[model samples]
Target: MYYTIGEVANATGIAISTLRYYDREGMFPDMERSSGGIRVFSDKELGTLKVVECLKHAGMSIKDIKEFLGWCQEGDATLPQRRRMFHDRLAEVERQMDELRNTMNLLRYKCWYYDTAVAAGTEDAVRDLPDEDVPEDLRDYRI
Candidate 1:
């Protein structure tokens, strides 16, 4: 079904301006215009938007996304390129997952340490960690 920008935003949980920007950026499927120049989106456009959102969430940059869209415009000739893109994205995602898991583990250990310290009546246990003992970038992550 076709939907107005507002309806599409509600359905996709993306901002109306984001949808408009995606259209303007050519990351969206071909869009049709109303008699008065308003944009109308079809089911295909909505599906494409969903895929775009997923790609963005997976850490694909807008520049690469536009390049991917350009490859898409090339039709069957671009399948190999698309496959390579997905392969690269998969590796990147795996690396991010590992980093996230490590961060979560660090946070969990810190929480456990604080909990134990609070129960033991030694708040300083949590507070006395030396800066050198903690990671440089991670110092900002602590509460």
Candidate 2:
């Protein structure tokens, strides 16, 4: 099935201008144009746009995605390069997750500290908590 540029934008929830920008960026190599010179999107083109959105959201730069897509068009010869790109993205995502986890842990520890102090009606009580009284994982976060 074919869809107009507006229809593709509506279906993908991306702005029409952004779609036009992507097209201008050579992201739609297989795109077809009507006899009147109007661009029309096929389902396959829509699928490619979805992938571009995914890679964009995954923190890949447009230049990098373009390079990756170029590699894709080169067929089996680029398999190793594609694999390495994904592996690199995975490591970066994992690193981000770890940083977020650490942030959450610190927030949790702060919450517990404040709650304990409020319950005892004094910050002094929480401050003097013995090592054994604190959560094992939060011990390092004690301030």
Candidate 3:
């Protein structure tokens, strides 16, 4: 269905100005325009914007996304390049996942430490706990 720029922004939860900037940047290659210069969007273009948002969330720079969009416009000849980009992004996401997991582990240990201190009515009580009594997962995070 045809939609105005405002409708697209509301549907996608992106600012109208940002959508206009993206249009200015040629991110929406197939977007149409009225004779008076108003931007028009279609459902397909909205889907494309959603993908652009996802790539931005995945840490891709606008320049890189523009380049990727260029490759897309180039069609089948750029398939391998697009595949490599996705593969590299996947590896980076995996690294971020590992870091997040480590952070979560540390936070969990801190929660347990504070909970024990609360139960015993003193931080010193938690600090004085025997090493063998500590959780195995939190051993490395022990003070």
**Which candidate leads in TM-score?**
3
Colliding pairs, model 1: none
Instruction: Write the residue-wise lDDT of candidate 1 on 17-127 in tens digits.
Output: 888888888876578989998999998887777778878999998888889888988999999999999999999999999999878877876776678588878977667
Clashing pairs in 2: none
Q: Output the number of the lDDT-best candidate.
A: 2
Backbone clashes for every candidate come to 0, 0, 0
Tell me the tens digit of each residue's lDDT in model 3 across 88-125.
98898889999999898889989999999999889998
Which parts of model 3 are misplaced by more than 4 Å?
Answer: none
Global lDDT scores for all candidate models: 0.83, 0.92, 0.89
Each prediction's Cα RMSD? Answer: 5.7, 2.2, 1.5
2 or 3, which is superior by lDDT?
Answer: 2
Q: Supply candidate 3's per-residue lDDT for 24.
A: 90
TM-score, each model?
0.82, 0.83, 0.92
Which has the higher TM-score value, candidate number 1 or candidate number 2? 2
